[model samples]
Target: MNKPEKIVAEDLSEAVTYPPEAFISREYAEAEPDKLWSKVWQQAGRVEELKAVGDYITYNICHDSILIVRDTPETLKAYHNVCTHRGRRLVGNNTGGGPKTVAQDKGAHSARGSQMKFGCNYHAWTFDLAGDAIYIPDKEDWQGALDNVCTSLTPVQVDTWGGWIWINMDLDAGPLREWLEPVASLIDPFEFEKMRYRFRYWGIFDCNWKVALEAFLEPYHVQGTHPQLIKYGDFYSFSKAFGFHGQTGFDSKAHRDAGTAVETSVHRAAGDGDPRTTIAQMQAEYWETIGASTSETLVKTAQRLPLELPEGTPAGEVHQYWMKIAKEADAARGVTWPDLSDAQVAAAGLALSIFPNVNFIPGPTFSLAYRVRPWGTDPDKCIFEAVALDRFGEGEEPETEWTFVEQDLDKWPYVIAQDISNMVEMQRGYKSRGFKGNLPNPWQERKVTNLHRGLAHFMGTGHLKRID
Candidate 1:
């Protein structure tokens, strides 16, 4: 409801700088687990994944593995995924339903109508959904060793907001709402909880986690990295950083006005043939040649854009026309459209970067979210996960699972592949002898600067000095 504090270009110019070593040093990667990862609350998964009473999902960050479960119809709980006896992972599969199992082959078992219990396969030690140690193999051998020990799966602070399950390793860490701050409140009206996961993807990137994350924080790189997008809209973006999170995107009016030229990919005057025809052609080529995935909602929305508005119609009026058409389409499909303000509607395609390691490009009907994290102690390696969420009509069933893809650029969707191509090269550049450190455009790349500032604060390194 209230406008958040803005971080303009001037604010960015005065912000701190970050060194190359932060992205390349193995020691820095190792230190993150304790300093940054453990202390902050990280999104584990969506509530849709664990909707039922015994449903559970496993989220691993650095060396910590957390198991989040639906304890009751209204309550959710999280615990360390380690066996109390030998530290074997309690759930090897990323997610599953019903009670946890000890059988190695039960990885794909669904939890429908099943009781909640977890038994470590290495030993028969078992625990309940509440993480209470219900049974231990050969208890007499320990001489009441388990009696005094607080053996319930080491509890991790867990909470849910906006349909996401978040976990904090530090018991005393701030609540999810507190950590998220204005960003949470800003997006709450979007009703993300009504969305469902359309797809999930994961890849092992050959670059540091920060390198991969920084790639999505701004649209400044779009002109060079995703040149094809220039045809559709202006690459110029307005960015705002509110403490640990920030967003960047072309406002709707700005986007429509900039897209008036024939040079713009998807914009054309009334006489330039049917707009839907051109859009369909471009969409087809995008999916086939560029290897980018397309969603039904995106295609339909773009297809409905009125190519021929009244001569000299204001951009705001044009955007309103589009929203009117979009709402009608949504209603026809049995989807409830959220009541949004003009600015919120303008931000349909805005991209957001939540501090630490989450980034997403939001849309009125769909969003593509990403989470990147360091893979162990390897500075040169990181795990990247992408989840596509969409608002579906009632009774629509969507399949959800991780689709592991080759880390090669050719295997990724066109937009993402372009970013990865740069990431690999940038990682190599950071290691070069002639390279110094990052020197970002204060206006266009301010989100990246804010990200580094947040990281530096979290790591207790103070502000990095400018190399120049």
Candidate 2:
């Protein structure tokens, strides 16, 4: 893959102005279903979730509910979740087996087999996997009423790419692969389909969907939002746009500098002792303060680094050693690490923003993926879902469920919690009378600008002109 050319903030000649009301207006939120959400292909669920012929999952976006089902060993289908008879929802649970009835229920009968079918709880209207109306009561009541009506469940366009099931409500919408564009090609080598979800979390935030989505698109917030990370790497980032999407790459110079500076400081403070010995002692104290031992990866990586290095050893030597340790660790876990270039390995932790609603923090062995969507019609509240995926050897995939985190927000991982801490307050600030439109840092926030520009294009707003 080609590395993205870094562009400085001052060199960007165009500025995409975003109005403040876009983040807080109910009318704008209401218009999204038709203008944006309906027209775009959105990820419905992971392909692994519906492996069996009868397995199915329901994905709800705003007021739209879609039922995605695995109809055969190789065929998957998606349909509107509403029963045609009375518009009642066909599936109430997030995921479950096909329609069946227990013998103990008063009005229930058994259609108990592996072939999944959807039975509306309201009137027991049954639809086959293909979404054809299979059974309905009182068939003679209105004999001609069903003659001209297309009673079968309405199917939305469905496709799969990168092991994800994507659905678009607009039947005329472009193909999924075409919509994904450069992002699809950029990440194709990672073999994301081989990864399984380690955990899935959902939280309701008092902020716009864009506000929540934008939080992960850039690393500039690291210095203020996550000060602890500064010691590990530089907060300065390089960003590049790909029309509808963009990515941010971090420079690790500060981390290398810190290693050497710490060594010198420790040597000076400890008098004539070997500098390596002094540095080792300092590392022990620092790790204790940060509680690094509690994290298995941190502990393993720390153990591999020499506690005492030669006085003139370059920090690159330490980084090379850590990479060696990482490879060994993966080998022990039965994982075959991908063949990646030096630049690709360096950018393993880069954050990428896919236009509309998805963002990813890609890693060599694991990745953190996020999806943000408006919750119902409320402009101030949105649903934020996070999924952590890890590469596992064959037959070792984890069995996980969507765990809602809003009830106990404190349970979220530290970095994620820190990012979330700023969201609610930021949303409140947007409603303040004194605030004006957003003023994004041209280079650091270019991804945010690219995202809004995509939104404008989809919403029929004027095209954002880029001044050469």
Candidate 3:
């Protein structure tokens, strides 16, 4: 049989010709920061990360440092990280308590329930967790008068779903679910509430975040950039689309059936603890849904399928939630265990991308969550971060091993060191003067074009004007 044609779909020549400056320009980055960051909602962090009554986390959105705090068991409130009194950053680091002592003053009860206030580190001006000003230290000494009304921490908009918190910089923006309505149900089933945070790694790519994001939205690069991935899996045509807050795309098919015989067990790494029983139960339940198989078969199947949802459908983060469940299922059964025989009842990944920034790719054994923040318009210099949650079975964590077709590190970054190497260089090349955009073969370029369209929509530029 003739070899399948390689899809060299992206027209790199044309893409590069659009002045690189357009993407990396500082002016572009600074323009409409609020409109870009606030007008749309962004993922803040997992809700459990801020479990305590006073627990809080800091987030950097469009250069603004935001402090998000839990005011009630189910309620999360956000505020400007700046202290109203001295303009100094209020909360520092990821998350923390106000201080050793939380002083109580005024009509607020210091009994330590919900009325606790936030005190400035500099002058000790106090504000409630609700971002309301409670007291000014030495009120009589200052002027016997202090404005409690204006001293409250500036409040920002926030909401929660799938046990994760989302904040909107634009207080004027409508409800988050209103925006997420288009893609929520599509991703909610993976039971994210149960998935453990297996590990987290970061890479600083010289390339723009958009480039980094674009890298994972489609499998077109599997044959070239990821030669090993190509070796292990077959690339199906790509399909993608955009919705209110994000985008969704995936490979056409990997031709593997769930009942295949590629089962291989995960290695037992020292210090890797046993799996969790709850997770194992969840995994078993998942296997009952999707059937058991090796990671290779599972991934290939995942790649070939479109999200089992219709285009432009709204679901409450169905993919990530479902992913947490699926990962637990895979971990419970073991990466390569064949105990999963109910082929009729397996739950696999249903990856989706939320426009402009997030790409939610939930695999059976793991999931890849990415955010594509624009560095510039050139689309090459943006900052991209890929966080992989490698979920293992319920009881103990095993020393996980990565498997790919070729041993080349660059092509398969699943191992960490390799992913960073390519990201850095790709960022540098965004500034290459010899640049020109390249042509994208129709079959492989679906995700790229879909994203371009999404960007153009948000930029409010006419579709024809897209620099693609």
Candidate 4:
């Protein structure tokens, strides 16, 4: 009897090395829409983006366009953005016009609509915020034929978590919270829903979406990519998998004690030895470079460390005093801090990723979030975006818009621009015969490999035979 030889996977990621083809193969890029993106829940925009009842935003992933609208204060609805009449995109990606040499003080609006309903710019097929096909210009001529066809925009699953609107095309997939799991449970105490966007920027990059995303998934690259930042204590961090999602956290005494999961210090916690000057210096560097992880309140409080604490104060005590002062300062400004317990406060990361492509660095009062999308079927292109979020008093939230800057990386805040500069070159290097696949730091990059392991689950991975 003849039997088929079973195939096995040669996951380089499992061996702390990333298979280069995923970043360089068109076939892999083409399969992702069906094998990955469509099956997962991805963030579209913040709940705040749809403040007014009729406000709507368009999120594009691969070839699919999703329209998300705020139907009412309590309801949000999502639909395929194509017009039912002629299949023309009902919305355009209005990621155009912004400064080149440097970033601007404000962001402009994304493809958005505020009317009670949307009219297809092509044929004027109008659909209400609920995606109900309200008007057909020549309904009488079409007769009952339209009945069989979905006259209404096809409904897509939509949900809100952590103040972000998410869309899922797979009707069979679980609810957003269900998929979120321990990752959400770990971060829920940070109360991300209370934060609003303070900075927004997106641009196309000559790299795979996963490549762009992997840049933020771990802090292991800090030494090579950000040498200047080494002066700020240590960027020491490790990664842990939470089912499909992953988190990278800084080295902590607590983790060392229990030998378990730890999170990156977005707060840039005080290090060993005297804490007075070191903690304040770390806070200032964060403010000057990325400008989001530590809030202005925390940065201001850190500045007082030298005067508030004696020269030889222990790092642990310094952390407590620093937070006490920051919380009081925030309270004075009517800013309500999230009610995080001592344990949760000590172990959250500077970075975490949700399944396919959403990454975030959670902090007490301000944080940074990132999203990456395929720019088409091109294995070498992706849409990269970063956002800054802050918790503010009742009415202090600033008005924000989606800003798209061109290829000039100089405009990005110092540290981010440095990261971007590495992307295009990395993609090019991956194609070279001399370059081997990526070797990730085992413990620190478990989060990066999880992305690959997840793809293999849906796509069914197999490996090539080795040479003798």
- 47-92: candidate 2 lDDT, tens digit per residue: 9888889888777777777888889999889888899999877765
Regions of model 2 farther than 4 Å from truth: 1-13, 93-115, 145-149, 251-299, 307-317, 346-349, 407-409, 461-468
Q: Cα lDDT for residue 452, model 2? A: 69
Per-residue lDDT over 285-392 for candidate 1, one digit per residue giving the tens place of the 0 to 100 score: 544543323346445565555454544554445445655666777788887777766455344336666777897665555567889877766788888887777788
Best by lDDT: 4
Ranking by TM-score: 4, 1, 2, 3
Model with the higher TM-score, candidate 3 or 4: 4
Which tens-of-lDDT digit does each residue in 299-343 have in candidate 3? 332332134434332222223233334455555466432223222
TM-scores for the candidates: 0.84, 0.81, 0.64, 0.89
Question: Which one wins on TM-score?
Answer: 4
Q: What is the C-alpha RMSD of each candidate to the true structure, in Å?
A: 6.3, 8.1, 12.8, 4.8
Where is the poorest 10-residue window by lDDT in model 2?
261-270
Candidate 4 minimal-lDDT segment of 10 residues: 97-106
Model 1 misplaced regions, further than 4 Å: 1-10, 93-115, 251-295, 304-312, 346-349, 466-468
The better-scoring model by lDDT among 1 and 3 is 1
Candidate 1 — worst ten consecutive residues by lDDT sum? Answer: 261-270
Give the per-residue Cα lDDT of candidate 1 at 114: 36
